[model samples]
Target: MKKFLLVFPFLSLFFYAGAQNKNLTMQDAMLNARTTLAPENLSQIQFVYGTEQYVYAKRSGNDVTWLTGDFKNKEEKNLLTLVELNQKLKAAGRTELKAMPVVQFNQGADWILNIQGEKVAYNPAKGSFTTLIDAATAAKGNVEQSKAGYTAYLDHFNLFVANVADAKQVTQDGSSDIVYASSVHRDEFGIAKGTFWSNSGKVLAFYRMDQSMVADYPIIDWTSIPAKNVNIKYPMAGQKSHHVTVGVYNAVTGTVVYLKTGEPAEQYLTNIAWSPDDKYIYIAVLNRGQNHMKLDQYDAVSGNFVKTLFEEKDEKYVEPLVPMLFLKNDPSKFIWQSNRDGWNHLYLYDVKGKLLKQLTKGAWEVLEVKGFDQKGDNLFYVSTEESPITRNLYVLNVKAAKSRRLTSGFAVHTTQVSTSGQTVIDNYSTPEDPRTILLSEVASGHSKTLLQAKNPLADYNTKASEIFTIKSAGGDPLYCSLYKPVGYDAGKKYPVVVYWYGGSHAQLILNSWNAGAGDYWFRYMAEQGYVVFVMDTHGSDNRGKAFEQSMFRRVGDVQMQDMMTGVDYLKALPYVDADRMGLFGWSFGGFNTVDFMLNHPGVFKAAVAGGPVINWNLYEVMYTERYMDTPQENPEGFAATDLTQKIGNLKGKLLLIHGMQDPVVLQQNTVSLVKSAVDKGVQVDYMIYPGHEHNVLGKDRAHLYQKVTDYFMQNLK
Candidate 1:
């Protein structure tokens, strides 16, 4: 703990740390954070679901161990020891799983653990101990397994289906305007878990959603006791949208079906794959001006419509996020992902759609697939081909079609693979290495570290960043980073703060590790002395698909002409103060810190903006019609990123944080920009949070970065 700050010339800087003598606090910048300054990350390497035969566990000050391995029988064991599964959950009175629970193995290696709220089923080579669901009969977010031993969850609001000795309920109309199973369009394309199973889970498929023809939106609940509106069904943007159907069920014929997926049941039937001979399923649909798409293929025990194998239109939309990958033992080819060749490559197709070749082309942008290498003849992905802010790891030989680069590390990797792909694990990071993990050997990339982590800010006052590259006004280049204010003194001008996020899937500096250093309150406002920068404009996020469709339909014109080429590299930084500069962001970096401080007025004097989107006809309709193509067809690109039609062209000192339950850019977008800055008398500075949503997260995000470091040290120090 080296802290310092003590300035005192009759000091009066209000809870100061300003001209950084050093020290830190807003609860040491949000509840004593800086704990090891971030690097201990091994969040995933488990592999027992669909087998690569892994296990992993490792703990020391009390010894935990598990281990397991087996990349094609290089074998290694241990397997059951988290203090002997907490001494068999303290001899079954349960509750001791505490830290290592996600080890889930099933096809014979018997693992399934879940502990505290119970769902046991252990086996470990016959140490036998079955309970599998019974935390007083399970219910909250229920359960959901299925490697044939079925589990499918949810009870209050029906839809069940247990296994370790029968349970089955399967929806009795849970009503409250029909839900059953959960997650729907609101969760957008990735569609987080709403069940799905098949290929041996013996039919499950889920997601029902009916939202009784939309329209509710009240949400008042100020911790109640007279404050209680709470309606929430909000479909907004041209409204009335929720219908989603997918059902199926069966669990050995308890019966259910549903997927006809036809009609205007409010379009968007998303990715949802299946077809490993579980009598077919697939879906991809989309149509609701989400510019056509039609991957279809249904009939899982008579849900019908088994046809349309290919289609993908897009005047400005057709999104279809991932779900084709089949080919693990060839159920008749698969692999699809597309940006329709503007970049996001990979096409292979089969099962009657024909195209069979296009496995990976480039401008760069594959991003993730990580599977098949166990006799499927190679294929493992993760790319930007090397820099869309970095992420590497390749392989692709699905019949000598070519592809190679298995991580020559600059960082941002992220592997796992193993089931005869011949080892992988990886887990990377890097603008200066803060997470290692190795394990390697996918055909000689060769390695073995298996865990590194330990930096969590090693003591503090952090700051050493530099990763360069600028040139944007259409000449491209971008990627920036900078840091400059940690005990610096280039004749001291200081101030500066930047931290943007120029949208389109976002990418603020990367070569992984410290490059994703994350804006820890701009590293606690560069330990409170400022000058922090971070760039990647021109529609960030893994560059490809013509660099994220270059702000199509003008979303803040190439993000303020690439943040005015980062304030002309911070007014040619001579220790950079440039009129005390400042800027930060939240939702779309609070709509680019108020659209680049009102379209570059004075190059930012002060700024904050959490949860901002000041109107694109109030956001959603599958992401503002795939990048602003609807305010009745880009009315001048939604009247130029519509910041409430440029909120009186805002000048400076702007704050406006929001989240009085922001269901995605909506606290009526800063109460309609403070009622259009009180009908243009103009003067803003707000903060809301209450029961937050769309962010201002936990520990109230350290009182939202101590009210954004006391409004940029009272308006840019």
Candidate 2:
């Protein structure tokens, strides 16, 4: 596998006006830079499997129009060309295109394409189409069909009804923002799965988030008339959060009942699951601080809270409830993940909340719940049992409670099992290996490679990466990888850049082949004579709940200690110059850089802290309260770790950069730190990227990386 920061340092300084012997526009610079950093291959690598067909929008090369495609077939098949499809509708005498086209399957009926705006349903087998609902009526959410089908579409959310004759609206109050029947986060990123649907699809339980109460952080478009502000309802840390309410809707009666939550308005109502019989709803409610969690069962019909299934309290903090299973077809029996036993493990519980068995007992944490097999005898999941830095697939007999590792290798493996649990798609990569995607039989362990990403930088003549294990000051072994420069020589020492993000609940060192934007940037930096190293410090995630919560009350102490040990380990390497080392990070990484630079200045010559949280007081209640407790309760600890107090201790050359409109870490954090440092006569270079946010996205990121490269070359070189 290739390290991320090994490719682009020479391109970083190509922007300097004084060094500008050649004319290079921003576009030219980016195009030239991307040539050195582009991934070797661009192919559809399997990430995960879902119940629905893989539908996504793509750009057409011919006319630069948007087209939708379905990834179910082996070959890429365009569902429709927007222009041609629109022209066909215009010929059919349709004035408007309201809803997009959707695919539906039925046992007796042919495959159908339901087109919005056109209000037409096309049957592929019959070669005929019919208008199901008028465009104006469909826009008003008045469409409905009897429920016995393999798939059914109701307004925005879809469902599979057992009896089409008995089907009705499960939710009545769903709108643009006030959605009740849909999944959260739009089926993108991690939180793609929906809340819950009954075994027979009779009762549909979902989360209705009231984001109207939350403030809309605007993203402005300069091209629009008067520069229209795109208001995004973003819930920042310590700020007013969106109110979440769980609802159990009856599809037969078209009635929606909100589950009774005794807690205050801002509490998080998450991890909702319905019983097999659809009589009761299970929900996990956590306080805004996220320390106290209560799992309650409610009557689906009456909307009355029946009893608390389980209550977990953590001295440090309790994580959001991660539900493993609803016990196959038995809703009364379920599996829940908890760290109350010091390590994150699975606990089987009866409907009455009595602990039935401890399904998984270990020091390591289960990374994913792959669901149970057909027999309901075996449970498959991913875990970091072998090492904290690496992940592998595993299976356990639910009845016998006997566990066995399914994957045997040092590389990090991420697996996604099919709904049947018979087949799995396993993708893995190590520091020295390219990523390989494989299809494997879960029971037999037979596998076939689907795609192997070619090493994109093979032609770049980059040096190899070395993996090492360094023990922290606390005796915990930390896994890290070091990327040597392209022309590394044993006799000549290279300036080291320790890329750090020692935040709780984040893993930096992984043996995955999918390199992100930051990883590519890191690789480019490494190619420029900087030996880049990344370590998963003490407070980082994927170890277990205890290891993750270890930084509570004492935010920077353990992480800094572990990072110092990593620095010491780096200094021992023959190719590293200990005195010429530097650090760079963003967000929590930025926080780590600022904390380390202030507490241990002599170790790093130059440091960059981008969008760092200088004080815990500025952060939000939900996230900050979980790890650090309330600032009032831990004033001493907060003061000790606060970056503002340690700004005067700055001894290294530092550069502070921030996006002017960052909502997560807020640009105010960087501004405050710089102001404090300047007031104390501490010299620090600062840059503000106008209209940027927590991330310098799009073309702005290229410019940001260039600036960072220039900073490192000027100070560390």
Candidate 3:
């Protein structure tokens, strides 16, 4: 590894020599960030469905006005106001809305506005509205709507289908142990929503999870009068997992058929897709070991296994998160994302699983697949080709095997392509610029700025921050960010706090606004006369597969090595106080905090770990096994990382915080560690948030941060 660090040349030095204004309060940093302190943007912004026109909400006080602009003419007008919308709804004999409902363009010029529990289709130009579905009466949990006028949802563990006039129950034998139309596998493998609607929208496929064989884990709700215990089915590592299967429901005939996914019954069915003709359903079937995956096709109507389209196997693990993206003009062809060559890129495949060619190739990962043009020849996507810290837009010509970058700038961009593929709405941000939305022509790449948000922290006396890179032990460039103390002096030493989420699927340092430190808490720490540092180690996201796979068997080993490298770098600096260093992280990061405190004893003066995973054996089956494997299979690996066994190694002041109702990383983890600490005669500080799950959100977040800040202040400051 290189001994010298390489600072990014393009990054503007945030150290302002001039006198600044007010400092950030905890409320302004934590509670009011997304509200009053947030950067302004085109609210509810998107291209009108199937049209080149785009619309966004503009709020002024109690009223919200929607503005629509044409892509060709660049003319924007007030499409409708809250009063006008309410007047139209009242005229149509529906209940009036006090505030503007979240609107989406569905059927041509009509607005599908979600008002309370009903999806109302309103046409402001025609002064008419139609109630599509009343969610309160008909649909509830995991609701999914289709263009074919069918709504599928789960009510009390049972699956139901609702039409215009009536609702039909799809499953009758659903109970607490038998769930229907719900996301299964603990939401791993990129499963966000429960139901999958076919292209024709006539068929709905959902998951049926039978966790009766699994044991129930109790979480005490302290908010209750007498502290009620809520029993949840949590499958720990090496334990008996829940059995899951897919159920296909026919809306036209009101029939249900279970997919004949003959298996060990404990496998994972992820990345579900449907044929355009709605005849076949494709699922990526992964074994419980999570090393082998088979992309299989099944007949939708018959519920019979058709064929295995393809298979992927890895020595460590093969994670398929994105579903097949079939071409719009050609249903027989699709795009698949894989990291087979050690980098996440796109590949072209026929329906028969024939590899046509690799469409994209490079070191950077393809972040998202936007969409294809009207001809399906050009594909739009977001990638880290320019830099891992920045996300930019790129358009690939499938036929020519060529690609070009559409959006420019050293910032993170999120884009929405118009249906015609002629234009794109690009939303991006940088440290100096809060946010900027651009309307760009896909063909020529000509762009026009729609909104350039004013800096929200203009009035605040924020300190200096910089995003740079330090070499890892293996010669890889690890990204790091540093926030200096307010009124920093080079002659005096200042206490330092290191923060990071050095885990899979997360990147803490970025090129966006506030350098990807979302809350003002970092600035608040800087205000308290302490330097803050964050680093995205090898295990973090957006890097290639090899960088993450390094943590396959041993989770915290590589990340700790890189983190210590960062610490060494900081100690060399004259302004950083090596003896007064501290650490902070939550969730996986919380795990890191404890790992560093124990494994590398006396390295940190103080640390705060929130919702930490104390024992890998106690963590959930899906996530823990993916990285650490089963405890029974790799007992030594689990034993090495388990913090409960190493409580005696802890040297400095450590504060452990947990949510009493945290289901993800259960409170049992902390209890187990505390029990071990007691046995070892070690003293540690602990705090708990009652009735909170996984994270302490809302107003409670400020309290949690305050507790963390106070602990660090009392110990390290």
The numbered model that scores best in TM-score is 3
- Tens-digit lDDT string for candidate 3 (1-717): 345566667767684524468888999999888888898989989888778788899988888999988656767999788887777767888778778888886345677877887877876667777777885844478888888889998887788888888889999989989988888899899898779999888899999999999999998877688988889999999999999999999999988898999979999999999988899999999999999999999999999999999999999999999999998878889899999999899999999999999999999999999888888889999999999999998999987778999988888998888988998999998777789999888878788889988777777888547888888988899988889998889999999999988899999988888888878899899999999999998789999999999999899999899988998999888999899999999999999989989999999999999999999999999999999899989989999988998999999999999988898998888888899999999999999998789999999999999999999899997
Against the reference, the lDDT scores of all candidates come to 0.75, 0.66, 0.89
Give the count of colliding residue pairs in each prediction: 11, 25, 0
Q: Which 10 successive residues of model 1 have the least lDDT summed?
A: 1-10
- Predictions ranked by lDDT, top down? 3, 1, 2
Cα error, residue 708 of model 3, in Å, equals 0.9
For each candidate, what TM-score against the reference? 0.32, 0.77, 0.98
Model 2 C-alpha lDDT per residue in residues 1-717, reported as the tens digit of each score? 111222222112111122213323333335443554433322232222332222233433533222222223345455445565566567667543543444443212443445645345554444455665445444533233322221234455333222323334455555545655444422211334444666666566666766676666665554566877666565544566666677765666767788888669887666776677778877777777777888888999989999998898876667754643677756567888877777778888988889999988878887788778766777898887876657888888876778878776666887766555666666776544456666676667776655576654444444345555666665666767677775668899999887878886577766554221224655566667788887778778777665667788878788888887877677677888888888998888888889999998788999988888888777655667677877677888778867887888888899999886676776667778878887898899898887787888777777887898889999889
Ranking by TM-score: 3, 2, 1
TM-score of 1: 0.32
Worst 10 residues of 3 by lDDT: 11-20
Q: Can you tell me which runs of candidate 2 are displaced by over 4 Å? A: 1-244, 514-518
Is 2 or 3 the stronger prediction by lDDT? 3
Q: Give candidate 3's error at residue 235 in angstroms.
A: 0.6
